[model samples]
Every structure is written in C-alpha cells, then in structure tokens.
Target chain A: MDILESIKVALEGIWVNKLRSALTMLGIIIGVAAVIAVVTIGQGGRAAILSSLESMGTNLFVVYPSSRNATTPITRQDLITLEDVEAIKNIVPTVKAVAPTSYLSIMTQVGRQKEKTTIICTGQDYKSIRNLELVEGRYFTSEENNSRRRVAVINEELAKTYFSGESALGKQVYLMNTPFIVIGVVKNDPSNALGFGGDPPKEATIPFHTGETLFRNLRIQIEGQTYSKEEVQETIDQIVKLLHKRHRNEGKYRGYSLDQEVATANKILGIIALIIGSIAGISLLVGGIGVMNIMLVSVTERTREIGIRMALGARRRDILVQFLIEAVVICLVGGTIGTILGTGGALAVALIAKWPPLITPGTIFIAFFFSASIGIFFGIYPANKAAKLDPIEALRYE
Target chain B: MIKISNLTKVYRTGAISVTALKGINLEVAKGSMVAIMGPSGSGKSTMMNILGCLDRATSGSYIIDGVDVSTLQEKELAKIRNHKIGFVFQTFNLLPRLTALKNVELPMIYAGIPSKERRERALKALDKVGLADRIHHRPNELSGGQRQRVAIARALVNNPAIILADEPTGNLDTRSGEEIMDIFQQLNQEEGVTIIIVTHEREIADHTRRIVHFRDGVIIKDEEVLTPISARTTLAALPPAGEV
Candidate 1:
C-alpha cells in the first residue's frame, strides 16, 4: 500500500477509538511539553541575565583584596584604601573612572515606612563607573565625599517603596538611625539581581567618607572602568598591580572583568539547564514505552483485521508499514500539541517572571525529531509481530 | 485454472503433529463454479487455505494459472494472491471503520492501483453487486446479505483469476443466502469468473456446477451436477422481505 493510504488507514483507526488514542498520546504530550518548557524557560532566563549583565557596565572590572590561604592571610593592611584608588587613577592611563564602594544591608526608615534595604557607599565617580542613570535630582558631589557629608542617593525602587507618591529628592531617610538627606534618586537597575537574588533590590547610596564614619571596619572594594572594551584586562592588571605595590602584599589582590564573571555565570546556568532538561527527557523515554505497550495491545486486538488484509493480498511489509505509520502519526500529533502547549507554558512563565521567552526553531525541530524517533523505536516490535502472524490463524481468531 | 497433485498439510503443535490433508489430487477449470463440502475437521478448510495461497502445502504441488504456488515464498505468494486470487470470509470481514466502497478498494490498493482508478473500479464492483446506493454505508450499517455483497465486490475489484468463498452465506438468513448465491451465479455465468465455495450445506453445494466431497482429509467423491440449481430463480420465488 502507498504511504498515504497507510496513513489514511491509521487516521481512521485513531478516529474510531478517539478516547483510547488520546489516552495513549497523553504520555508523549506530557513528555514533549515538559522538555520544551524547560528548554524555553532556561534560554529566556539566560538571555535575561546576560542582557542585564551587559547593561550593568561596559569595560568594567572589580579589584578587591584577596583572602589568600591561611598560610598567607590577607591583613587589614592589604585592604584597598582611598589612597590605592587615587594611585590607580594617577598611575594607570587606561583607567577612566574608579569608585570605592561598600555594600551593607541595614534597616532604613522614611517616617512610618521602615524596611531593611541595601546601602551602597561609594565615591562621586560611582555614577560614571556603574553607568547609573538619575531619574530625578542629582548624584552626590566630590565635596560631599571629601567632607564626609551625611547625604544619600536612593534608587527608583526605594523611592517608590519608601516615599510612595512623594518625591524622595531632598527628603530625610534614616540609615541605621543615622539621618541622611536624600540628594538624588537613580533609576532602578534590573541587573541588581547579580548582587542580590533574582528580585531587584531597594538601595540607598551615601558618600564613601560618610559611610566610613557611620560604619567602622568597612571592607572596601574598588570598582574601575577602562577607556574601551579591549583595555579592560590590561587596565585591571595595572590597577591590581598598583594596589599590590601600595599595600606591600605582592599576591594579595585580584582583579576580574565583569564580562569574565558573566561568562562564568552563563556556563553555570547552561549546566543547570542541561541537568533539568535531561531529567525531563526521562519522561519522553517513559512515554515511548507507553506507546510500545499500546501498540502491542492494538496489534492483538486487530489480529482478525490483519488477517483480512493479509487475505486481501497485503504483504507483511505492508502490514508493518501500516502499524508503524499509525504509531508515528500518534507521536507526531502529540508532539505538535506539546510544542503549542510548551510554548504557551513558557510564555506564561516569562510573563510572570518579566523575561522574554526564547524558543528557537532548532528547539522545535529537535523536539520533532526526538518524538519521531521514539515512535519508530517503540513501534517496531509490535508492527513486526503483526506482520509475522499466520494469516490462517489470525483469520480463525475470535 | 488450478492443478493439485499428492497435496498434503501437516499441522504441528509442539512435538505432536496432526495431518490435515493427505495425498489430495484436484483440478479446477477456469470460469467454472465448484463447491467443496465436508464435515468439520474433514480438511476442506485446509484445502481452501492452501488453494488461496494463505498456507503452503507440506508435501505437494499446487499450480494456479501456471504458477507453482506451493513452492512460492511468502512475498511471491502474496503477489500471486494479490493479482490472481480473492477471498470472502464466513463472517464478512470488512474493516468496521471503513465504508463499503473503501472495503471494496482494499485489494486494489494492495495491487498498487492509483487512487482515481481504485475508486472508479470499486464503485463499479459495488454497483455490480447491486450495492451502489449503499457504498457509503459502513459494514455495521449494512444487512448480512448486503455485507456479503460488499465482500463479493471486494473479491472482484482486483480482477483476480479466482474468487474463494469460505462459507460466504453461513451467517445470513435463507433469503439473504439465496441473494448472495444469486450474485455469485451471475458473476460466474455472466462475467465468466472462476468461483469456489467451501460449504457443508448440500443445498448450497447443489447451486454450483461441481461438488467435491471430503472425508477424513481425503476427497471421497467428485461429481458434476447434470443440472445446477439457479439461485436467481430461487431468490425470485421466495416471499418478499424488508429492503436490504
């Protein structure tokens, strides 16, 4: 029989037992759906993170004191100080801007609104080093950092959460009970998830000297930016060398570019996605087994029909092709439905998570190929069994 | 035409074996109607299966239309069956999901006929069996007599050398049986089709031109009827029944 003819026959068979066919296809549906959903969500998350990392800074690297092993510990003397920052600015021609910053999670309050929030204590150049945009007011000036003025710049998220409808500029907000006036409000950065968890954090920034006075024993980190992307590594090397020389600790400082960190993060995310996807693939294998089981039952149920076809001069190959086509049709239909459902599921997740879903045509093609392979792999035994039946015995079957 | 010499069939069950047909010799001419009648387990069905190329003989030579079917491989036998033989079952084994027209087209499909020609020939065959109006009806929707007629249409759609009917009228009422016998006789006398019917009923065998009686895996009697009964006349004389 022609392939089209066999397909027609298979469709008729499926249509005749609609509920059974649906139940049989449910396994494949769920298997493919899970696989597609995982892949799409993983890709979307990776894209979101990478894009946010890109927006964080350009040609940026962080230089900090390394905690060398216990055999050669890093002392307080090795910490990156304001003098080291000045030395890098003066000595490194590749360096464009540098900011000495400290991150502290503390309780802050504006009138009745009180919450625990992150405080970014940095120099005036923090804005240029981090590419921070100001939605309202302005960043603290060099005068504020030099004189240890009690002033703060709040992010848009903190503005919305703490101040409500009131503008946060020139308002008084307390950090660890030390009152500081809000000098500016910077735009909320979605890429803040790198420091915090996935949720963007509410942040208030203060002058570096003011932070040193307010909180003692601060571990300072020097964030620097290069003139261009190509100069990032060289610039970081110069900055680290300057710090080592100033601190008199030869191997006590490490500098890494933001791009390198992001690459490592991407690798880790890829491994995680692969692990989850393979776990989902186990369901597809189980689904294939389900197809095989149903096909065997169908072959047994249609023994007399097989006999009739054989008596009508159907070759064994024809019989085999018929059943194989039936199985493949079932899986392909299930796979198509799964692609639709999985895409829908990924979109729903992306909607809730505020990320764009990344579903490529290659993902869909791989899904199709896998489902077809499962059908063929599982379909062979039963179809071959049907083909090998003795026509006389099958005809006599009740 | 078919020629059989020293044909035998042995069925094995584990280590035990039962001989079904022993040294049977038979000949059937083209365009002739014949009936093989026997009691249950008398090997008539075995002989029919062998003749239809559904089974191979153990130690015999059976030639159909100049081809030695007994020596043919599975694929070759299937091809010969597709081109040269057709079958009708006792239970009217039409695929339940298909319409009568699709059922008729089954053999032609295996014969690799194109769709348009397959449909055209299937319609013509259904019309020949007086089931043109019911071609769209599934097997369950047709009466026993109409179902048998659909089977006959399927048998003749491929234009095979011979039509094998295994108790074709066994499941039908007497009137329906007469109607089926009428179609068979018409196809035989009018179309010059070779037909063989396997039945135990003496009355059904009397309608054919020749009858071969089997007893204990051997043909005991082979005789030609001087005057064969006419199924059309028999059907016409019966009381009128519901539309089928």
Candidate 2:
C-alpha cells in the first residue's frame, strides 16, 4: 500500500477512537510543554543577567581586599581605603571615577515611621560611577562632601516607606538619633537580586568627610568604572601596581564586577535548565510508554480487521506502516498543540517576571522531532506484533 | 484455474501436531462454480485457507492460474493473492466504520490502484451488486444481505481470477441467502468469473455446478452436478422483494 493510503487508514482508526487517542497523546503534550517552558525560561535568565549588569554601570569592576590565609577572613590590614582610589586615578589614564564606599547599619526615625537601614559613605563621584538616577532633589555637592555636611540622599523605597508619599526634600530623619536632612531621592532599582551594584539600597548617602566624622573605625570598599570593557585589564593592573606600592602587599586585592557575577550566574542557569529539562524528559518517556500501551491495545482490538486486510492481500509491511503512521500522527498532533500552549505559557511567565522570553526556531524543531522520534521508538514493538500474527488464526478470532 | 497435488496442512501446538488437510488432491477449472462442503473441522476451511493463500501447505504443491503459488515467498503469495484471488468471509466482514464504496476499494488499494480509478471501479462494483444508491452507507446501516453484497463488491473490485467465499450466506435469512447465491451464479455464468465456496449445507452446495465432499481431513467425493439449481430463476419465481 502507498504510504499516503496507509496514513489515511491510520487517521481513520484514530478518529474512530477519539477519546482514547487524545488521552494517549496527553503525555506527549505535557512532556513537550515542559521542554518548551524550560528553554524559554533559560533564555530569559540569560537576558536578565546581561541587562542587570548593563543597568548597574557601564564598563565597571569592583576591587576587593582578598584574605591571604584561611584563618584571617578579613584582618585589620586587609582593607581598601580612600588612598587606594586616589592612587588608581593618578596611575591609570583609562580610570573614570572611583567611589570609596563604607557601610553603616543604623535605625532611622522620620515622624511616626522608624526603620533600620544601611548608610553608604562615598565621594561626590559616586553619582557618576554608580549611575544613580535622581527621581527628586539632587546629589550632594563637592563642597558639602568636603566640609562634612549632615545631608543625605535616600533611595525611592526608603523615601516612600519612611515619608509615606510626603515630600522628602529638606525633611529631617534621625540615624542613631543624629538628625540628617534628606537631600535627594534616587530612582528604584529593579535588578536588586544581583546584590550591591544593582540593588536599591534602603539607606542614605553622605560625603566622605561626614562619614569619617560619624564613624571612628572605618573600613572602605573602593569600586571604579573604566572608559570601556577593553581597558579592564590595564585598569586592574595599574590599580594592583598602585596598591602594591602604597601598602607593599602584593596580590592582596581581587578584582570583581557585575560582569563576572553574570558569567557565573549564566553557567549556573544553563545547568539549571538542563536539570529541569531532564526531569521533563522523564515525563516524555512516560508519555511514550502510554502511547505504546494504547497502541498495543489498538493492535489487539483490530486483530480481526488486520486478518481481513491480510486476506485481502495486504502485506505484513503494510500493516506495520499503518500502525506506525497512526502512532506518529498522534504524536505530531500532540506536539503541535503542546508547542503552542508552551510558548503561550512561557510568554505569560516572562511577562509576569518582567523578562523577555527567547524561543529559537531550532529549539522548536528539536522539540517537535524529539516527540516524533519518541512515537517511533515506542510504536515499533506493537506494529511488529500486529504484523507477525498468523492471518488464519486472526480471522478465526471472534 | 487451480491444480492441487498431495496437499497437506499440519498445525503444531508445542510438541503435538494435528493434520488439518490430509493428503488431498483437487482441481478446479476456470469460470466454473464449485463448492467444498463438510462439517466443521472436516478440513474444508483448511483447504479454503490454503487456496486463498492465507496459509502455506506443509508438503504439497498448489498451482493457481499459471504460477505454482505453493513454492512462492510470503510476499509473492500476497501479491498473487492480490492479483489472482479474492475472498468473501461468513460474517460479511465489512469494516463497520467504512462506507460500502470504501470497503469495495480496499483490495484495489492494496493492489496500488490510483484514487480516481479506484473510486470509479468501486462504484461500478457496488452498482453490479445492486447497491449503487447505497454506496455511501456504512455496513452497520445496511442489512445482512446488503452487507454480504458489499463484501462481494469488494471481492469483485479487484477483478481477480477467482472469488473464494467461506459461508457467504451463512448469516443471512433464506431469502437474503438466495439473493446472495443468485448474485454468485450471475457472476459465474454471465461474467465467467471462477467461484469457489466453502459451505456445509447440502442445499447450498447443490446450487453450484460441482461439489467436493470432505470426511475428516480428506476429500471423500468429487462429482459434477448434471443439473445445477438456479438461484436467480428461483428468486424470480417468488414475490419481488424491495429494492436492495
């Protein structure tokens, strides 16, 4: 029989038992759906990492004071200071700006609203280096930072939470009972999950001098952005050489950035996708078994019909083709439906998570063929069984 | 035309063997109407199976038309069966889901006939069976006699050398049975299509020109009927039934 003719017959058989065929195809549908959802999520995760890095700063890196031994995680001597930031600026031509940062956690009271928040102490260049966008008011000036002014710049979350929609500019909020006026409110950062660089800190920003005046024992963390990504190596080398000369502690400082964080995160996300995909693969295998079970039942149910065809001069190969085609048709139908539904679900999830879902044509094809091959792999045994039955006995079957 | 020599069929179950057809020899002339009659398990059905190429003989040669189909490979036997023989089973055996035209086109499909020609030929065959208006009806929608007629149309669609029927009228009423027999006789005498029927009823066997009687697994009597009964003339003498 012609392959098309056999396909026609197979379609008729599937149509005759609509509910059974649909139930049999359910496994493939869910299996393929999971695959598509995972791939789309993986693509979204990679994109999120890239965009998060870009939003934090342009061509940026962070310098950490590395501990030389296992016992001393952070010693008194292993701390980046303001001197290191100044030295790197004078040493490297590509150096844009360096913000020597220090963290201070304290309780703040604004009228009836009182909460604990961290305070960031950095230079006037912190505005440019960290790309801090102003939603209201303005950042502290060089004179205010030099003279140690008691002024502050709060983020959107801190301003909204403490101020309760009240105007934050010129308002006084006490940190550890020391009243400091709110100078500005910065825009909310959406990529806070990446940690320091992209996080919208619930804190105030004061000048380098005022921070020194407030805290006696200071441990500074210096971060800088460069002219471009290509100048990263030169900037790091110059900073390393400068720190070595200033403190005579060679290899004491380690370089990091949102870029490195992204690379690590992407590697982790790739593995995550694979793990989830493998779990989904198991579901697909189970679905294939369902197809096989249903096909075996169908073969047995149609044994007498097979005998009639055989007696009408159908070859064994013809019977094999018929059943195999039936199996494949079922899988393809389920695959097509699953692909559409999966893509839709991926888009919905991406929208909810505020991430862009990327679905390549190649991945779609891979998923489609994967399900089709599953049908073939599971279908062969039953088709072979149907083909091998003795026509005389089959005809005699009641 | 068929020629059989020392035909034998032994079925094995584990270590035990039972001979279904025991060393029987028979010959059937082309365009002749013949019947093989016996009780159940008398080997008449076994002989029909071998003749239809549904089973292979154990130690014998059976030639159909000009080819020695006994020595043919399984695939070759299938091809010969497709081209040289047609089958009609007792239960009507019409696929209940398919319309009469589609059922008739089945054998031609196996024979690789094109769709347009298959449709044309299937329609012609259904018309020959006097179900031209009911070509689109599924088997369940048709009566037992009409179902048998559909099966006959399916058999005739391929235009094979011989039509082999196993109790074709066994499931029908006497009038419907007579109608089925009438059609077979018309195909034999008018179209000169060789017909072989396997039946146990002596009256049904008497309608054919030749009857081969089987006792146990061997043929006991093979004789030509001097005057064969005419199913068409008998039906004509009775009251006219509704249009089939």
B-chain TM-scores per prediction: 0.98, 0.97
For residues A5-94, what per-residue lDDT tens digits would candidate 2 score against the true structure? 999999999999999999999989998888888888778766876687678764677777776523446556657777677777787788
Per-residue error (Å), model 2, residue A206:
2.4
Give the residue spans of candidate 1 off by over 4 A.
Answer: A194-199, A351-353, B242-244
lDDT of 1 by residue, B1-244 (tens): 8999999999999999999999999999999999999999999999999999999999989999999888889998999889999888889999988999999999988988999999999999999999989999999999999999999999998898999999998999999999899999999999999999999999999999999999899999998988999998887889999775
Question: Positional deviation of B14 in candidate 2, in angstroms?
Answer: 1.3
Q: For model 2, what is the error of residue B167's alpha carbon versus the real structure, in angstroms, after optimal superposition?
A: 1.1
Best by DockQ: 2
Clashing pairs in 1: none
